[model samples]
Target: MTGENVNDTTGDMLRVEDLSVEFRTANGVTRVVDSIDFAVPRGGALGIVGESGSGKSMTSLAIMGLLPKGGTATGSIRFDGKDLLSERESAMRRIRGDRIAMIFQDPLSSLNPYYTVGVQIAEAYRSHRSGVSARAAKKVAVEAMDRVHIHDAARRADHYPHQFSGGMRQRIMIAMALSMEPDLIIADEPTTALDVTVQAQILALLAEIRRDTGAGLILITHDLAVVSEVADRIVVMRGGHLVEKGSVEDVFSDPQHEYTRRLLDAVPRIDDEIGELRTTAIPVVAEEEKR
Candidate 1:
């Protein structure tokens, strides 16, 4: 919403410096995201990996200006050259779906039950692009669905969210995000609750989309394996603190933090001779626990 062109590809697409999120309650102030810093280069993918309550999702919400009641975010969230933390809600509304789109973990909860998937996607597009005709917007929706590899997208667009399987529903979410052609996409736990095969497919689709569209991606998840497959860099967080940050290969091969090492250890492995695949899981650390 600043007069600056968000589409400028000169520098990092996003940069967060000393970002902190706090909540004020009857009890007192509690900090959930504490002085964390990271960046996503233009057209690059960054994975924020941490356990539940690590503030990964909260950080994303803070950037989107969707923080819940009593929550406050301080410090810098720069998108292109604009400081989002200082922007008014009105300005953020204009920038959110247009320059920055977010995909949540639960597609069913995000999508409306009564509306057709096409209608939902078209509405999202129209919300950001004023004066766009309904027919044109619908066409964009179909195109987006197809872009995400939804077969027979034109026909599938007419179906309700309930009609689609879990994987298909997630694709609809991605299509909605893609319809706007946002500059940055913040996906929070996008692969959660999906099967291994579908998870791999979705990750591949995300990688393909980034490669094709050159849109910067921030994937927030607990699975190191998922990030290893899709993200170029990884940010490891624990108890609201950044424990480690480096390339995916570096972090996977030689994790600097003990917590990170434990997380990598928790990732399930496959034994070729045994022909068995193990389940993948992340260790849950309590809020008060010190790593």
Candidate 2:
């Protein structure tokens, strides 16, 4: 999958145009992310929100050039003034962890159980930086762990992924991403596996990392509240289509689509009437999108 060159910097860190992802199966080609377009300016945050099977993760994977087998992505993904989709696999390999980093939802699954946390982080750092010795890389790994507020990072770095709690493992993943000091960070449902308190902590930590490093952030999730908490702008997707997008205040206060309204209405509120009836009906707009 490749795209034509479009040299439009204009202060944007990442620019995507008519991006689409499809998977070819035994039956036929199924589009998972359809003609979506958005931008993340340098040091800015963009949130992609939607329900399950909405192609939020697929969009991120397409940008990373990590699509699964039989999956193909078309259209333009411009990153830092270069067309990512046009780059060769080797070029993408250099850019992936060095210029762009990703934080997946499940750290346990993402991290290798056979390796120590320190070694994994060190290898990730050393992979992009040539001529870095193992000792130096280990030091960098410990420092990265410390940066994420991992307690006793130097000691914990020697432990395997299973030795850490779910939240701790997630922090380790964040530390690994930060070790590269990438210009862009794409977090896909980063808080999905944690408790509410830990989720808030992780979000705050991510916000702090962005603020401190001035890296562009793309957060993908289904929770509108989570996006509202951290994202400066939001794009709402449904059934692989981009339904609406705007500033946090704009979209939340004045949703222009029925699907967006239904999503907002479905959120449980603390001050609701006792035993108040809640509607479980899917909106007509959403139903049409499914079809």
Candidate 3:
């Protein structure tokens, strides 16, 4: 986590202001994102939530400077006071994988089955800092695995992507992201492919990492239940536009908009729903007795 490494996970991180991305399609021009503004403080977590096609992923990819071809991005992404949108490709190379890192949802697609997991994680750390030996890099990979709560770090390090389960592969992806210790981590639906319990574990790992390194975190997910446990604040997007933004409690307990209300209503609460059923059943029993 040396300051020079860009993986220091320190300092005020990313600020995205008035960000927009548009694509020229055969039909016409489509504005996928429009003037979205959000700032991730030095040590905080922000969750971006919306249904599919809300442009949450594109916003993060824009921040990472990884937008696909034919998409024109406007506005500014300022990270550590450096203008990301205007930065040269060479300068962006330094920041893209080092200062700011990302973890995608599908590890199967991200990690190469041919390469060993340890090699991939080490390459990420080695890419930023020079003169690092393979042994040291491998140790960092193992330690990252341990940090993420992966059992048998050394054994798991040697395993290929196909060897590990879905949850394990996702952990391996997370290990790679944290191995470099980036200052800001943008996780795009990191747990989307995992089961409920595994998703909880991954979120907990992310919470632990943010606490340990004090890095700004932008967790992109449509699952409000997942974000509720970890995010300090939440941003809601709809139809490529900003819909609602507020603290978790504010949005959950006192949603100010109809869309937010519907989103919350869509979440299935086991205890509350069961209690309602039981309470209604008691009235049914009483009515039967009266009959």
Q: Quick one: best lDDT, which candidate?
A: 1
The TM-score measured for candidate 2 stands at 0.89
Candidate 2 off by > 4 Å: 1-10, 269-291
TM-score of 1: 0.90
CA lDDT, candidate 3, residue 214: 69
lDDT of 2 by residue, 115-221 (tens): 99999999999988999999999999999999999999999999999999898999999999999988889999998778777888999999888887877789998
Candidate 1 lDDT by residue in tens digits, 1-291: 332332344788799999988887665677788889998888879999887778898899999999999989999999888999999999999889898999998999999999999999999999899999999999999999999999999999999999998899999999999998888899999987687778889999998888788788999987777898889899998778899999998999999988788778767652121211123334444233122
How many steric clashes between backbone atoms does each model show? Answer: 0, 0, 0
Tally clashes: model 2: 0
Candidate 3 wrong stretches, greater than 4 Å: 1-12, 269-291
Give the TM-score of each candidate: 0.90, 0.89, 0.87
lDDT of 3 by residue, 1-291 (tens): 322332233554677899988877666667888889887777678999877677899999898888888877899899889889998888888887787888998999988878899888988789887999999999999999998888899888888899988888888888888887787889999887777778788899888888787677899987777779789889988777788898898999999988777777766662244211122111111001111
Model 3 residue pairs with clashes:
none
Candidate 3 or 1, higher lDDT:
1
Residue 274 alpha-carbon offset, candidate 1, angstroms: 19
Ranking by TM-score: 1, 2, 3
The Cα RMSD of model 1 versus the native structure comes to: 4.9
Residue 280 in model 3: lDDT: 14
lDDT for position 252 in model 1: 93
